[model samples]
Target: MKDTIKEKVASAVRSVYGIDASDAIEKASFEPPRKKEFGDVATNAAFILAKVLRRPPLEIARQIAEQLSGEKEFTRIEVAGKGFVNFFLSPRFYEELLKKIVETDFYVSDIGKKKKVLIEYVSANPTGPLHVGHGRGAVVGDVLSRVMALTGYKVDKEFYINDAGRQIKLLGLSIYYRIQELAGRNLTLPDDAYMGEYIVEIAKELMLKYPEIVDMEEEKAIELAAEFGKKVLLEEIKKTLERLKVEFDNWFSEKSLYNDGKVEKVLEFLKEKGLIYEKDGALWLKTSQFGDDKDRVVKRSTGEYTYFASDIAYHYDKILRGYDKGIDIWGADHHGYIPRVKAAIEALGESGDWLEVILIQLVKLFKHGEEVKMSKRAGNFVTLDWLMDEVGVDAVRFFFLTKRHDTPLDFDIDLALSEKSENPVYYVQYAHARISSILDKAKEEGIEPSTEHLNLLREEEFELILKCYGLKSTLESVAKKREPHLLPYYLIELASAFHKYYNKNRVVDTDSPELSSARLYLVSGVRKTIRSGLNILNVNAPGRM
Candidate 1:
């Protein structure tokens, strides 16, 4: 639709000025005007052409508007401001769009162009339960995968388990020492050890299974403890994510890179390519040569590989798997980690653009205008499971995306639990339910939705149609910008439009059968569009509050 408008403006420019404005036309943009009174859509082609035509922008705009005045799809084309042409779409145009939306699945788009994409997110270490921070990334990645797949991209979701590092060793030690304490050994846990109560629980479970673990060698017992702790925590992580309705297609383990010898192999490959060097008794990668701030050590002086080494191997594995793109969703604190990873990719003869990282900031939960800081369950941090139990999976998933992922979000617990319109998720869901009731009441009166009398749709009905038509564009924007917040905002706006329309219009009036039928069709489109938007976000569209 936007392309059609751009072509019409280009043709108008050619016909009126007797000159091809192809180059300037490329700079033109058709977007919604700032104010509703301005029009439905506006173009800045005249501003782009003023430089080429050596005329005032206002003069060019007036000429273009006059040329496009007779367009069938536009009710009026008026020159606004100094050089903007605002187009008021005809009612018939919206009527046709609404009819199509009612009769078809019209929200899908080809914006992704069928590219194979791998989205890895919420790769939290398997040492403990997932916190709210992980929950935020989980929702972002999950929704993005859905949006990308709907937009013609073949996407696979992944969770990278960071189970092969100092953290895992510490987790094992934490549990091993707890078991020793259970066996009546006077052992004091180190300050760096995992102190959560869940650690003791894991130790208790392991103790029941391995009664002789206390007598085993320290190194061997720690390994056994680590394996048990990892398995138990990983299963809990999966269950928690499932509780929130977030599922991944793959659970890639960082340990697998070492088990498969890929980590050592990558280092050797880089060494052969002259990208690795020895310095200060450590093996370092020449990351600075590929846009990093400085060289990075892949292997420490203690003969242990850093996490960066495994990450490089993992991403190289992703490239070897033939994905067109790999998106990593990391915590916002890992902002500096991006350049180094991209550097690793470039050092390996791949374009830095092959890898994209989305940084998810922290989520601060609030209740009754006060920050709720502690969670008794996770010891120091709030767990995703506890939050879901407090509110619901729908609120957790929906609220996580209420703001831009890169920005910190202050989630209001009271608002989430509220049943009023102040709650965004509730408001949108209520719109779906309200429309369902309207349609049900219409059906009871034998006034079925019909597109035959769509011409009878008035200004408010056309306005609702235009809002419903925005679903496709919203999904496209979410896929392109990687911003899932736009979908929720779009849903809120659509619901608000519907609510306002419902408050003013009577859809099941017996005196006006034709108008009632036309309005019912519009109402049905709103319901379908709302349900579709909510479904993409993995939120429910309830038929009743």
Candidate 2:
């Protein structure tokens, strides 16, 4: 419906001023008026076009309003303050919209135009299990992936494993020391080594599998322990992600960048372009030339490649694979890392904007008005798996998205477990279940949902119908803004509208059978929309609560 209005205004500009306003058309937005009395939808197209057409906004708005006032879908079109054109849609528009909703899935859109997008997220190191912070990024990426795919983007979900580097070495050393201690050998565990109990468990398992590993040479034993520990922890991460309904198409190993010589390949290219130089016996990239605050070291003086080297190679590989865009989900602490990565991409001859980074802020759990800290299983921080077990997959996924990805989220456990409207996930799901019960009861009463008398729907019912139709815009906004949190809020508002309508209206009046069928049909659209939304979030929409 918004698109229809946009196209009409674009046509009006072409017909009125004989100017190609495609750019202005793209910039214009048709949104609901802030006040209910203003109109159903309002557009700032005239204001956007004024700069192009060189006319006063109010004059342009009046012209556009006059051009649109005769459209059959709208009862009136008014020129409001500062060139805003407000459109009052007619009852017939609501009738047709409700009919479209009942007859088909009207919310699906093709805004993405088949763009190839790679969303890499939850790329936590294999040295430990995924913590709550990683869980937050995982949900953001997964939900964004789902929404993009629904809107017609060819999306591939990926996890970039930091399997090569000091972290993995520390994981191995941590396990190796635990093995020695278990074998009654005197040793001091390094402070930097992993302190999680899972490390000790991995060591015990490694010892059972390779009994002589305890007596093996230190370097060799630690190497084996590191590999074994990485495998075990990575398997645990995959299982936890699956339990939370998150899956990835690719698990790209950081080690592969080295094994396949991609890091050297990128360095050679940069060197040939004179973008690489040596300083203090360490190789540096002229990142500052491309907008970085200073040069970045790709190789340390001791000769080990830095993590930035592999990161550059990884992103260069992403571009080589023909992805139109790459999205990386990282912790907010990595904010400073964004410029250098984008600078590397720019130096490599791709637009820096080709890669987008979403920084996920911290997630702190609250129970009984107090902050809940630490997971006994994870040793230092809360684990995603533990949180899921404490509540459920649905609650965890929904609550993670209750806030913007870049903002801090304080998850309230009591509210999530509650069976009240304050619990957003419950409220949305209950709306679905409630609608199902209504339709079933209507069926038992020998009435079937029909769009035959949708015009019988009252003003409140039309408002509910309009809210149901908002799923289209909600998804478009999410895909455009890369904000999945809007989806939960949209569903909540839609559900609220339905619940209010239910409290104030009757749907199964036997004497008014036509009205009953029409109301049931509207109710069915709401159920479909809520279920569709929950499915995108990978949450369950139960028929019974």
Q: How many clashes does the backbone of model 1 have?
A: 0
lDDT of 1 by residue, 1-545 (tens): 46457778889889989998977876788888879899988888888899999999999999888998988888999998899999998877787688778888788877688999999999999999999999999999999999999999999999999999999999999999999998999998999998778998999999999988999999999999999999999999999999889999999999999999999999999999999999999999999999999999999999999999999999999999999999999999999999999999999989999999999999999988998876875778888988898899999999999999999999999999999999999999999999998888888998999988988987778778878988888898899899999999999999999999989889899899999998998999999999999999999999988
lDDT of each: 0.92, 0.92
Itemize residue pairs with steric clashes in candidate 1. none
lDDT of 1: 0.92
Off by over 4 Å in 2: 10-23, 35-37, 47-70, 79-84
